[model samples]
Target: MEAPLITADTLVALIPEILALAFIAVVLLTEVFGSRSPNLSSGLAALGALALAGSATVLLAAGFEGSFFGDGYVVDGFALLFKILVGLVAFFSVLAAARWSARTGDTGEYMSLILAVALGASLLVSGRDLFVIFVSLELATIPSYAMVAFDRRRRESSEGGMKYLLTGVVASSVLLYGLVLIYGVTGSANLSEVAAAFTADLSPAALLGLVLFLSGVAFKLSVVPFHFWTPDAYQGAPTNAAAFLSVAPKMATFALLLRVLIEGMPETAQAYTWLFALLAILSMFAGNLFALRQTNLKRMLAYSSVAHSGYILAAFAALTGPALETAVQAVIVYAVAYAVMNLGAFFVVELVGEEGKSFNGLFRTQPALAVSMAVFMAALVGIPPLSGFWGKAWVIFATAQAGAWVVVGAVIINSVLSVPYYFGVIRSMFFEEPAGVGPVKDGSGALRFSIYAMAVFTVLFAFILGPLVLLAQAIGL
Candidate 1:
C-alpha cells in the first residue's frame, strides 16, 4: 500500500487554516439550524480569528514548518506573519462592526462571509503552485463580492458589487491566461520549478505571461491604472466592509507577490523591478492627485489606499538588490502600518458618516473621537513618532539604502501632496462648528472601543517599530 500523502506534521502546520474552516462550518450551521443571535455569530467569527492568529503565532515561534500536497501548499514564518495579519484584520473588523451588526441583526451570514475571506487569505499566503494561488485568490475574492453588495437593499451596493464582479472577472481571466501561458511554457505549475527553469533571456510567451500575471496582481494591490474599481467599491460598500477589504485582500495579495518575486521569480527580478518602479511612480502621483478632488471621505480614503499602495511598492521596487530580505521586510511593515491607520480611519467613518462634511465640528462634539481621527490622519501624512511615520521611514530607509532614489522621491512627494486633503479633515473636525447634536452615528461602545484601540496603536506604534523589524527578520519573506 502507498503511504499517506498527508503526515501528522502537515496537520499541525495546517492548524490555522483548518481552524478558519471549522469556524466557517459552525457559523453556517448556526445560521441554518441554530438560534439567530447576532452576537453569538459575530462573537464566534471574532473568536475564530483570534484563534487563527494565536495558532499562527504559536506555530511561527515553535519553528513549525511544512510543505504539503506536492509543494502546492507550505507553512513557514512568512505565511504565519500574513495569517496573523489577516486574523487581526478580521477580528478588528468584527469589533468595528459589533454595534452595527447588533443593530442590524442577522449577522450570521455576514460573519460567516468574513471568516470565509479570512480562510482564503490564510490559504493564499501559503500557495506555492499556480493552481493553488488561483484557487486561494478566488476563495479570498468571491466572498468580497457578496460583502460589497451586502446592503442588497441599496442600489449603489448592487451597482458597485456588479461592477466589482464584472471587472474582477476580467482581471481574474487575464490572470488565468497568464498562469496558463506560464504553465504551458514551463510545463509545470510549481513556482520553484518554474523559477529554476527560467533564464535571463526568456521566451516571448514567458515575458507576456510575466506581464499579464503582474497586471492581475496589480489589480489586487490597487496599483494605479488598475485601481478604477476601488473608489466606487469603497463608496458603495458598507464602511465596515470597506475597512476589511482595504486591508485583508491587499495584505494577502502582497504576500503572494513576495512569494512570486522573491522566491519564485528571482531570475526575472530586473524586468519585474523595473515594472514595479514604473507602477509605483504612477500609482503615487495618480492616487494623490485624484484624491484631491474627492469631497466624500470614503472616496478620498479609497484614493489614499491607492497612494499608500504606491508607497509600499516604492519599497518593493528596491527588491533588485542583494539585500532583498530587507526590502521585503520594509514592505511587510508598511502593510501593517497601512492596515492599522486605514482601519482606524475607516472605523471612524463607520461611526460618523462618509461625507467629508461628516467630520465638521467633530472636535466640538466628541473630543476622544476627534483626537483619534487626528492621530490617524497625521500618521497617514507620515508625521513623526506615529505608526505611519515609522512605516514610511522604514520604506525610505530600505529603498534609499538599496539606491532606489527615484522611488523614494515619489513616496515623499506624494506624501506632501496628500497633506492638504488629509489635514483638511483635521481642520474641519477641530476648526468647524457642529452641524447637529450627537455627531456620532453608531453610538456603539464596541465601535468606540475598537477605534480607540487602533488610535492607540497608531500613536504608540513607534515604540514597537524595533520589534516589527525583528519579527520581519525572524519570519522573513
Candidate 2:
C-alpha cells in the first residue's frame, strides 16, 4: 500500500502535454487580460506548438524510454513518432487558425481550443491504460465539437456541430460500456493486464465488449455505416476546423485503435482481422461511390476521407503474425501521407470556394495553386511518384502478403473508382472556362505556407521513404 515514487523521467515524458497545457493558459489569459488581439493569441499558440515539437525532437534524440505512473503512460519510439506528428499538425493548424481567427475575431477561445485538442491527441497516443485512453479521447474530441460551431453566423456550422456532438456522445457511450465490460472480465484497466487475461478462452461478455469497442472506434474513423455525420459535419464546419478534424482526430483514433488492438488484444487478432476486413471493404466502396456524385468539394473530400480510412483499415485487416509488422508500417506511412495530402487538399478548398464549380479556370488564374491542387489530387488517386502512391502500394502489398485477397481487390477497385472524382476536380481546374473575370485571391501567408509546404512534402516524400520505412519499422518494435 505504499505510494509509487514519481521520477524526473515521468515529468520529461509528459513535456508535450505540459507544454500544451501551459500554452492553453497563456492563450486564455491573453484573451482576458490583454488587448484581445487575434494575431498575438495565434502567435503564442504557434510558438507553443513549435516549442513542443522542439522538445519532442530533443527527447527523441536523448533516446529516453520508460513507463510512468504504474505504466499508465509510456514513452517509446511509437509514442515519440506520433507526438511529433501531432505537434506538426498542431503547428500548422494554429498557423491556419491565426488567419481564420483574425477574420472571425474570436482569437482567445479559438487558439485555446486548438491547444486543448492537441494536448488531448498527444496524450491519447501515449496512453497505455484504458482509463487514460478514454480520457484522452474525450479531451481530443470535446473542443472539436465547439470548433465545428465556431462560425455561429452560419446555420450549417451549428447543424454540423450538433450532429457531430450527438454522434460522438453515442459513440462514447458505446465505447465506455465496452470498456466497463472488459474491465469487469479482466479485472484490470491496464492494457497489458487485459491482454494477459485473454490467454484463456474469451467469455461472451468479452466478445461483446470487443465488438462494441470497435463499433465506437468506427464512428471516429468515419468508416461506412458509422459515417452518416461526416459530410454534414465537414460541410457545415468552418473550413479550417474541417481540415483539423479530418487529420488530427483521425490520427489519434488510429493510434488508439492500434494500441488497444495490437498491444491490448493480440490474442484476438485473427478473429478481429476479418471484422476489420469487412469494414474496410464496405468503407472503400461506400466512400468512393458516394463521393463520385458530390458537387461540393467539402462533401467530396469527406467521402474521400472515409475511403482513406478504409485503406488504413485494410492494413489492419491483414494483421496475421508475419504480416503484422508490415501492416503497422503501412498504417504509419499511410497516415503521414494521408495527413499531408488531405490537409493540402483541404487548404486548397479553403482558398478556392468549396463548390466544384469554384475550381473552374483555376489553371488560367492561379496556375501555381492549380498545379499544387493537381499534385494532391494525383497523389490521392495513388499515382506514382507521390506520397499517396507509396502509402496505398504498401498497404495493398501488405494485404497480399497476408493473403487477404478480397481486401486487396477492394483496394484496387476503390482506387480505380476514386480516379473520376479526383480527376474531375483536376479537369475542372485545368480544362474548364472561368466563372469569374480575374485571378482568385490567394489566402493569408500562413495558409499559403501550409498549402505549399504540404505540396512540396507530397512530391518529395518519395525521396525520404527510406527514413520513413525505418521509422515505421521502429514503431513495429
Candidate 3:
C-alpha cells in the first residue's frame, strides 16, 4: 500500500508522543554507558523525560488534529489530554520510587522500566487502532511485572510478580481474542471502523464480538468479574510499583475504552448499557465491601481503585452528549488526583517502616504524616471539602444525566459503604493509639514534597473541577 500521506501538521500533532519515545531511547542509551550511579541516572532521566513529555504536550495542545500513516495514528484533543495526564502520572511515580530504587541498589533497571512503561502508557493513550492498543498495553504491562519483583529478596514480591504475570497473560489473551473478533466482524482493526461495523448489522455473531471486546476492556480497567488479580498484585508489588500500577494503567485503559466505546461502537451503546450498569454495581459493591476487611494499606487502596473503576463505568453506562465529555474529564482529573493522593499516602506508609518497623504504629510516632495520610484517606472516601468528593460528584452527575439512575444509586450506596474502609486508615492513625512499637521516622525531603503536593491537590481538586469540565467539553470527546 502507498504510504499514507504524512503531513507536517500530523507530525507536529504527534510531537509529544514521538518525543516521549525518543526520551525513552535517550534514557536507555544513557543507562547503557553512563558511569554515574544507575539510581541517580535513572531518577534524573525519568524526571527529565516527564518534563520533555510535558513540553511536547504543550506543543501538541497549542495546535490541532494531526494524523499519521493514513488514519492509523491520531493527534487530537482527546489524545493530547490523556497523554499529558499519563506523563504526569508516570513522572510522579518515578519520584515516588526514587527512595525505593536507592535502597534496593537497582535504580538503573528499575528507572529504565519506568520510562519504558510511561512510553507504553503514552502509546495507549494515543492509539487509534486495535493492534496498537494491544501492543501498547503489553508494553505497559511487561515492565510492571519486573517492577513488581524488583527486589528479589522479598518472597512476597516474587509471588506477586508471578501472579501478576500469569494473570496478565490470561487477560491479554482474552482481550486479544475479543479484538480478533472485532477485526473479523468489521474487517478492520481501526477503532472507528469497528464502531461503524456495529451499526451495520445486528447479528448474534456481531453481538458476541462486541461482548467479547468489552470483556477485555473490562479486564484492563479492573472492572468487576475480571478484577480478582488486582488485590493480590497490589499487595505483593513493591509499594511504589503498586502506586504506579494503580494510576498509570487505569488512565490509559480508560482513555482507550472511551475512544473505543464512544467513537468506535456508538451504535452498541443502547444494547451494552445494562451490561456496563451491572458491572458498575458489582465492582463498587464488591470492591468497597472487600476493602473494609483489609488491614494492609496497599490492599485497601487496591480495592479503592477497583471501586473507582466501578464509578467510572457507571458514568459510561449513563453517558449522553456533554455528559460523556464531562464524565471523561472527571475521570482524567480524578486519575491525576488519585495518583497524587494514593502515591503520597503510600510514601508516608513507607516512611513508617523507617526505624526498621512495619507501618503498624503510625499515629503515635509520626503525627504529621498520620494527618496527611488522613487527608488522603478522607479524599479517597469522597468526603466533602476534598477533591475526591468532587471527582465522584461529577461522575454521579454524569451517570444521573445518562438516566442510569439505578447505576447512580448503586454508586452512591457504594460510596457510602466505602467511607468506613477509607476512614479505617485514619482511624488507625488518629482514633486508635499507635501500637507504640517503636520510633517513627519521617520521609526524605522529596517524599515530603510529594506528600504535601498531593495533600494540597486533594484539598483543592474540587475548585479546579469546573475548569477541567470545561476543558473536557471543548475536546468534543
What are the TM-scores, per candidate, against the unseen true structure? Answer: 0.98, 0.97, 0.93
Give me candidate 2's TM-score against the actual structure: 0.97
lDDT of 3 by residue, 174-201 (tens): 8888888878888998887777778735
Off by over 4 Å in 3: 1-7, 36-39, 353-364, 435-443
Give lDDT tens digits, candidate 1, residues 1-477: 865789898899899989989998897788789998887888898998998999998998898887999888989888998999999999999888777766656588888888889999999999999999999999999999988988866798878888888899899989989999999998999998889756668899998998789889899888988999999998899889999999998999988988988777886874567678889899989999999999999999999999999888887777876658778888888899989999999999999889988799999888889999999999999998888998888888888887888888888888899999999999999999888773545447778888999999899897777888898888776
What does candidate 2's lDDT look like per residue over 386-450, in tens digits? 98999998998889999999999999999999999999999999899989853345447888788
Model 3 poorest 10 in a row by lDDT: 352-361
RMSD of each: 1.3, 1.4, 2.6
Pairs of colliding residues, candidate 3: 195-264
TM-score of structure candidate 1? 0.98
- C-alpha local distance difference test of each model: 0.88, 0.88, 0.74
Q: Which window of 10 residues has the lowest lDDT sum in candidate 1?
A: 437-446
